[model samples]
Target: MTALHELTAEAAIRAIEAGETSSLELVDAALERVTSDPWHAFLAVDEDGARERARAIDANGERPPLAGIPVAIKDALSTRDLTTTAGSRILEGFRPVYTATCVERLERAGGIIVGKTNMDEFAMGSSTENSAYGPTRNPWALDRVPGGSSGGAAACVAARQVPLSLGSDTGGSIRQPAALCGCVGIKPTYGAVSRSGLIAFASSLDQVGPLARTVRDAALTLQAIVGRDPLDTTSLEWREPIELPAGERLDGLRVGIISELNGEGIEASVRGAVDSAAATVESLGGAVEQVSLPSVEHSLSTYYLIAPAECSANLARFDGIRYGRAAEGADSLLEHYERTRDEGFGSEVKRRIMLGTFALASGYYDAYYLRAQKVRTLVVEDFARAFERVDVLMSPTSPTTAFPLGERTDDPLSMYLSDVCTIPMSLAGLPALSIPCGFADGLPIGLQLAGPAYSENRLLGVAHALEQALALDQAPPEPA
Candidate 1:
């Protein structure tokens, strides 16, 4: 028999509704896996609260859709009384009095929060190694990284500690990690999910989404959290009902293979998988063709500029005096601020802050930040033009399969390049997702699917069609 902890979230929910399993049993099973974890995927586990919440759900006369499902939340989001460190010591032990609107929405829809997962400090790094709590190991290969800044959220799902997890995506944080971990992850159309209480990495770029073992499971979690939230003015009302279509027929669909994302640096194996996937799309009655978005060539350069600039500004508030913990024994006010930030933030967070400050400085703003913004406009135009010709786009989610931990920790440029393929869509505030297509060197490779703004319904429908046609079993292997 499969362990309760191994079941997909959708399966668990069905079991609970059928009285085949209870919420308490599922929560306890999930908690057991989390507590015995070797992957360091979680920052805090709310054992008592989770059990209490599960019991209440089990006792309810009319169970809700996700009544018994256990879901992990990334540590970056405010969780009311739950500790939300944002994977940094700067705000250690800080619990918000208010919950992020999306998290509240999840609870309201009957999903139980099992714990807060680990992440890159302030969501700055490309790998979980930057996490103040230590790196989250990939379940497929213990020595490899699960990708990051949402590494823990992806690892937790890939390792089967829980079937679904909430994670924030900023410059590929969610999709890259999900790809490396061999699970499904989504970066909702920006504003599709409110960012109200999510600690900012880059306010303009950050968006909350889900990582799950299956597409439908992810859709369910997404449906629960997405909608208009007055607290976030950028949020858009999702007036259309979210429906996950079933099966392998994508007849009359248009599929564009992004030439830039697919060419150059992408590993041969990853590229081959994508090519095979394109052929499969063709077989599904979809028109498959290569489409070039030339401005995407500058994606890495523009992302580094815009993301860091926004991060520098958004992170200014964590001065320790107002939020986070201040270091002891500082005589001068400036010294206090310096010591607090130096002691609280990780190297990557500080690195980006400095880079951003340099970019936005008095004399160089136009040369760097302004040019990047202009280039960003070009990128948006490129996508807009391409979408006019194609309904959806495809590529390898990451250029390479999961690399060993510490491989690029000291090489920031190499780490930054990891997001090259996923960042363009993020900059455009579009919806995209990564799903397991095939394996290379015994590790999972992700095939990314993206669509125009507010096109999640079409994107997901196409992804589901491919998911069914490919029929790859996404569950990660047990640790050797």
Candidate 2:
């Protein structure tokens, strides 16, 4: 029998509805696995609460779509009564009074909250090393990083601790980590998922999505949490709820390879796999061609400026006065504020905050932040032009495969380049996903598939086809 922990959320749902597995049985298995993981994928494991939720589901006569399935929420999202640190010590013991809308819906759909996953503090770094709790190691290569911001969410899914988990993407936080960790990650169109109660990173760029071991599982988790919510002004009514497709071929579909994201800076094996994915699309009767998004060359720079500027404004609320952690023994109130923040935020978070503050400062606003915003629009335009020529676009999710932990921690520029391929799609607020494509030296590589805004159904269908063709046996090694 397949271990309950190994079953996909879709399969778990089927079993629960068919009277084959009890929610308590599955929840117990997930808790055992999560608590045992050495990868530090989770920051908190609500073992008792999860078992209680599962028991209640078992007693119910009806089964929800995700009934009995355990899910890990990214630490960045607020879970009422659950520690919601956003992976920073600044908010150490704080818990939100209300859960994030997406999370509220997730529970309403019958998913059990297993734990809160770790992430880069304030979602500012690329390697997950910026996490105040310590970096989440890549499941494939324990010595390497598991990609950042959403690292813990991806790692747990990749480690098979949970069938699905939530992750917030700000400049590839979700997709990049999914690539490194060999799991499937979906970054929905910007407004597709409600952000209310989520710990803000970069409000405009951050989006909540799901990480799963399979395309179908990811789609299932994504649909439950999406739709317009009154709490979030930026939320949009989805075109339609996401429906999973099981077809194995992408016949007559048009897939474009983003020229800029493919060539320079990308690792050889990753590039080969992307080329291979395109060929597989052709074999499935889909047309493949190269399309250019010339403006993406500036994606990295534009992202650093825009994301940080937003972070500065959104994070200002964390000042010593209101909540979380505060400093004492300062000679003055201003000194107190400085001391609190300096002691609270991690180095990377501080760096971005400084950059953002400077960019928004009186003398530099026009030269930096405003210019970055204008450049951001150009990136959006770039995608719009390319999408007109192709129904979907393909690229390497990251420039390289998982690198040794701490390899780029001291070199921030090198770390930022890790998201070079995935950042452009985020800037455009388009739906994109990273599916495990192949491997390099046994390390997983991921191929990114993206589409126009609100085309998640199309992108998911196409990725499902590619995933079938690849048929990678990507399970990570057991903890020793």
Candidate 3:
């Protein structure tokens, strides 16, 4: 018999509704996994609160869609009264009085918050090693990294600690980690999910998304959290809940293989897996063809500029006077800001902050930030043209599978390259999903499917079809 903790969110919900298991049983099982967490996946676990919520649900005879389902929230999402460090020492031990809009919705939908998962500091790094608390290990290989900045959220789900998790994607934070961690992760269309209360990484690029074990599970979670929020001006207006289409047929689907995402940098094994996935799509009666998006090649440069610039502006509020770490004996205000930031931020965070400040500085703003924005428009145009020709686009989520934790730590450039394939869609503000396609060297590889903005339904439908046809079992081996 499968343990309660191993069940997917959908299955757990069904079991709870059928009275086969109580919410307390599922919460206790999840708590046990949290206690035994070998990957440092959780930053804090709300054992007592989780139990109390479980008991309330059990007593009330409530059968909400996600009633009693254990969920791991990435530490960046503010949970009222729960510490939200955003994996930075600066905000360490600080608890928000108000809950993030998405998290509050999840709780209202009956998803029990098990704990706050780890992440890259301020959602900056491609690897979770930049986390102030420490890095989250990939469940597939103890020494390997589960990609970031949503690494902890991905790691928790991969390790079976929780059936569902919420992660913020700023330049592929959610999907990249999902690929490396061997699970399904989705970054909904920009503005599809409200950003209110989610700690900002890049205001325009950051979006809250779901990482789950299956496409249907991800869809269900998205349905519960997605909608208009007056608190977020960027939030889109959509009255109907997102529904996953039934069946695996892609009879009229036109799948476009990203021409630039393949070749040179991608590993042969990773390419093979993507090739297999494409074939699977073709087998499902879908038309597959190669499509070019030239501006995609410039995405990395454009993203580094725009993302860091926004991060610099957004992170300015954490100068110690307001909240977070404060310098103890600073005689001057300037000295206070300097000392507090110096002590609070990690090396990667500082690097990006400096880069952003430099880019946005008067002398160089036009040459750097403005040019990047113009190029961003071109990238968006590229996607628009491609969508006119193809129904959806596909590629390997990352050039390779999970790499050793310390493998690229010293080389930030190499670390940034890991997100090259996923960043372009982010620049275009399109909806994309990453699902396990196959494995290479016993580690999972991800196949990414992206579509035009507000086309999550089509993207998920095609991905679900490929998922069923490929039938790749992504269960990571038991943690060592």
Question: Could you tell me every candidate's TM-score relative to the true structure?
Answer: 0.99, 0.99, 0.99
Candidate 2, residue 151: CA error in Å? 0.6
lDDT of each: 0.91, 0.91, 0.92
lDDT of 3 by residue, 92-197 (tens): 8999989999998899899999899999999998779999999999999989999999999999999999999999998999999999988999999999999999
**lDDT comparing candidate 1 with the true structure:** 0.91
Model 2, 1-480: lDDT tens digits are: 788888988888888878899889998989998998799999888999999998888997666778778999999999888888888989998878889999989999999999999999978887789988888988898999999889999999999899999999989999999999999999999999999988998998999999999999999999899999999999998868799969998888999998888886888999998898888999999999999898899999999999889888898888777779998788898898899999999989898899999999999999999999999899999888887889999999999999999899999999999999989989889999999999989899999999999999999999888999999846888868
On lDDT, the leading prediction is 3
Candidate 2 off by > 4 Å: none
> In model 1, how large is the Cα lDDT of residue 143?
95
Clashing residue pairs, backbone N/CA/C < 3 A, model 3 = none
